[model samples]
Target: MMFENTLAFARKLDAEDPLKNYREQFYIPQQNGKEVIYFCGNSLGLQPKSVRKLVEEELEKWQNLAVEGHFTGDNPWFTYHKQFKEPVARLVGALPHEVIVMNNLTTNLHLMLVSFYQPSGKRIKIITEKGAFPSDQYALESQVRYHGHNPDEVIIELAPREGECTLRTEDIISTIEQHSQELALVMMGGLNYYTGQVFDMQAITDAGHKAGAYVGFDLAHAAGNIMLDLHAWQVDFAVWCTYKYLNSSPGGVAGAFIHEKHAANTQLPRFAGWWGHREEERFQMKKGFIPIYGADGWQLANAPILLMAAHKAALAIFDEVGMEAVSRKSKKLTGYLEYMLKSNPVMEKRIQIITPENPAERGSQLSLLVKEGGKQLFEAISAAGVIADWREPNAIRVAPAPLYNSFEEVFRFHEILSGHLR
Candidate 1:
């Protein structure tokens, strides 16, 4: 764990890492044709080389077979949608039947709310963190409004205690208990985007159920970055985008999970299209809708082969590096980054990490609360070829994806920050 120099330390970590080989699998960025330090996987992930080959096969199938490609070609488009289920299901720790690749994140959230959030008059409240992702907030609001209810009356936002950057578990549990009688759905992000706090999902799910509510999550920041046991936790439902940690390309197809218990409950209403219909009954043009049980019941259209192909490429890598191994390396990589950042503060006062110090409480992302010329300092970091993101007034986000990021990269980024801060 010791470095002859910072670079040597990083190279050593890379040498000992079982997952280090994956760095070559991605299309890393360059400045003057040299690889740049990439710490932004929490935003847009680097592309996998296999993505092109996967997409090209589909393109070739389209060019040659045309409509016949649905049942022809290497991976026929006929059952193309089903191809994504197994890998994605394993990635999030769910049964194959319990997961499906489908629409974008917000859209899937809205669709899930339709069947799961059956809020009856008085017991129609929704619970979430106060400053959640904008898409999640918007979906929750639209769902409330769609139910002929005012969001102000039915939405309960849990906030951190004064001066605390992260939500206390006690606060979340108490908020759910306080609203038990009126609570209907507990929809939240698995990890906070700004604070980098990983919520205790198992505890939260248990509490929500005790409150007589359906518990679900937006794992946009959690999937691939953290270990999840949604089925074991009894999470009623969940949705996530693959573009972030999954490295599936931007605007990639999203995936969802529905507990096995909800699979056969046909009484639950869903917004169905041909894809959700029973495959045998689908072409039959049946008079009444019959859903494919479990996660398959949520689909509304055919899969986008191009996007799913890209996703399959990424998932293949994840399949190679198990979640436990990825998460194990993640803590060390990010922990090292944090240590280096704190080390630079004496050299410069403008840098302060808002992310929680506890390793179990955060993924790879670290949000920095700058003390001076915040945006200017961030721009300087960018100019120095460190590609992290600056959000809002004064915070910058850097995530060292275990798949490609290295200890040396962390050291190099700090070298740039120290230059400006000093």
Candidate 2:
């Protein structure tokens, strides 16, 4: 679709958007008594207007029911997390039993590694992308150390081909095949946090399996931003946080997915907890740890009701519109953002987009690399009521979220940025 750089054109697209009403569901942040142009959903999403009421209802249940709230509320606290299964399953394209809302992303990653990253004999190596989110890098390094192996020898970091900003799928597949003999696990972010590049998960999963390895993903940036098919892709496992594109409150409950193939395997090693024990016999308080049959078996504790409430509020919006619709709007929103940035004569000459140019290779985010005065440009935009993200040493990341961001805001951001370009 050809885009025009005029306010009228942006407003026209906004008026015609099928999901345009969704913007009213969220509470956009205000700066100096005005709504700021928010393009930071890749870092943190705007809060849904319904969150307060959902959370208040939970508070009321606790106030009225006390200890009985565990089993007596509208959504019983005892089985609170179960309600998320269907909606989240739909989002990730998995069976209801394959997904579960649980601890934060990194904790779930460690739990997944316990079950899937068993390195033995000649198969003692793990492959991941270079410069992954810091938590992922730390998790891999520590996991290797915990097994008494040197990270330098046991972990392979795949880098971009010399001059490229993003990794090539061919390079990733070949890396998996190259270490096939010793590869025990292949893990990567579904959408890279820094470059905003969306990796080919299906291809990576197939290559990993053929290479005799377990595969998983950190979908922090991919979960609500892109349409995923964890089950169809045969991903061994995956984890994601809810605060970014999912629009749950900060530090909201995270989620996990374990393929059905592994979910029912009771003998799989895990750090067990009482909540994961078979529900029917849970109250019997038996000495043995009899596991539940699926992803729920991986739970380490009972649900955090308030956080889950916030998650529920946000997911209801996703369920209403459906991922296919959300993804369609997302492509157009980011495309407009990209087009406007490129059309700015000053910006086009002074900056470069580090994100993959193809829409299929990214979601809503576009990472810009300024040739000079990167920090100054970031500050100038911020002062002008544009809320974008800046990474140290150069890139400025902007994501025009489909649920709440408007095409007019995208055009306005371009106008603000153009005025700041050196």
Candidate 3:
């Protein structure tokens, strides 16, 4: 696995990559008529080439069938979301009945919180990571307030130890234990959006359960980027967006997973809709709510057919490649990115990587904390055709998605960055 900071070495790796052909399956964006080295999959994944046709087919169905599309198309709009269960379940390592494709990420998070974030009497605190994605922060804070509790008192945010950029698993577990008496929910991002640190979900879930708390994860950054076994981890619930890493279109339909143990509990509180009613009893339009027996019970509305079509197109690629193969290539691709960045003398002095160095503790992203000229450097790379993302203040996040990004592109980015640093 020796890596050399040379174009030849990068090309060699690209030639050897089993997933190399996947690059052609995506429509890479162009700058001045040339393809940009796209490393922003952590933000928005590149569109799959098949997306247009998949979406068009749905359009054609609507055009031809109109209202009849609901029950008559090849994939009936009535149950279009059902087709996603198996692929998404496989992607996140859950039982087919345990997962469902539904609303956008934050909405689903709120729905999950309604059912799982019950706070009774003195046990009413929620534990989450500090500097979480703003949507998560707002969701947790608002949910606390809705229950008539003060956020400062009811929410405990675990911070990284001073001088470290990522949360240590020990620190997280200890914090749960520290507030065990009052902890009602333990929720965190499976991967930190800024630092790209992958939390130990199984450990966190076990610790939460032992402390008598419901455990959930916001897998917005982790779902398609890493291997997740939500069921085996005994996670009570989880939610993720499809756009990033999953490569569905912008604002694609999001997904949720509820462990079978929780899914069968019909008495669980939720904000339900008719789509979540038992299929056989749904058309009766009775006054009482009869919930579906699994994760489908959490659905708030019928499927968004077009969004589901886009999601299906991207997931088909994941199903074909399999997460195991994707994980293997991801480790090597991201490792090469890290190696090339470190090997550049100018970069070594000008930037610091905030992401975890261990592959197991991270996914495909590397968050570089630029020491000087951060904005200018980011702009320079952009002008040079490297489409990486810049967060506020100083960090530049680059993710080499295994499905479409290539090793040579990573090398070219380093070359562009090195030239800019000079």
Estimate every model's Cα lDDT from 0 to 1: 0.88, 0.94, 0.93
Candidate 1, 104-140: lDDT as tens digits: 9988998899988988867899999999999999999
> Candidates sorted by lDDT, descending order?
2, 3, 1
Q: Tell me the deviation in Å of residue 187 in model 1.
A: 0.5
Worst 10 residues of 1 by lDDT: 1-10
How badly does each model clash, as a count of residue pairs?
Answer: 1, 0, 0
- Residues 18-96 of candidate 3 have per-residue lDDT tens digits of 9999888999899999999999999999899999999999999999999999989588888888888888899999999
Report the C-alpha lDDT of model 2 over 1-422, residue by residue, as the tens digit. 99999999999999999999999999988999999999999999999999999999999998889889999848899988888889999999999999999999999999999999999999999999999999899998998999899999899999999889999999999999999999999999999999999999999999999999999999999999999999999999999999999999998999999999997798888999999999999999999898898899998899989999999999999999999999999999999999998877788888999999999999999999988889988999999999999997799999999999999999999989998774
Residue 152 alpha-carbon offset, candidate 2, angstroms: 1.3
TM-score of 2: 0.99
Of candidates 2 and 1, the better by TM-score? 2
Give the Cα error of residue 242 in candidate 1, in Å.
0.7
How does model 3 fare in lDDT?
0.93
| Backbone clash total, candidate 3 | 0
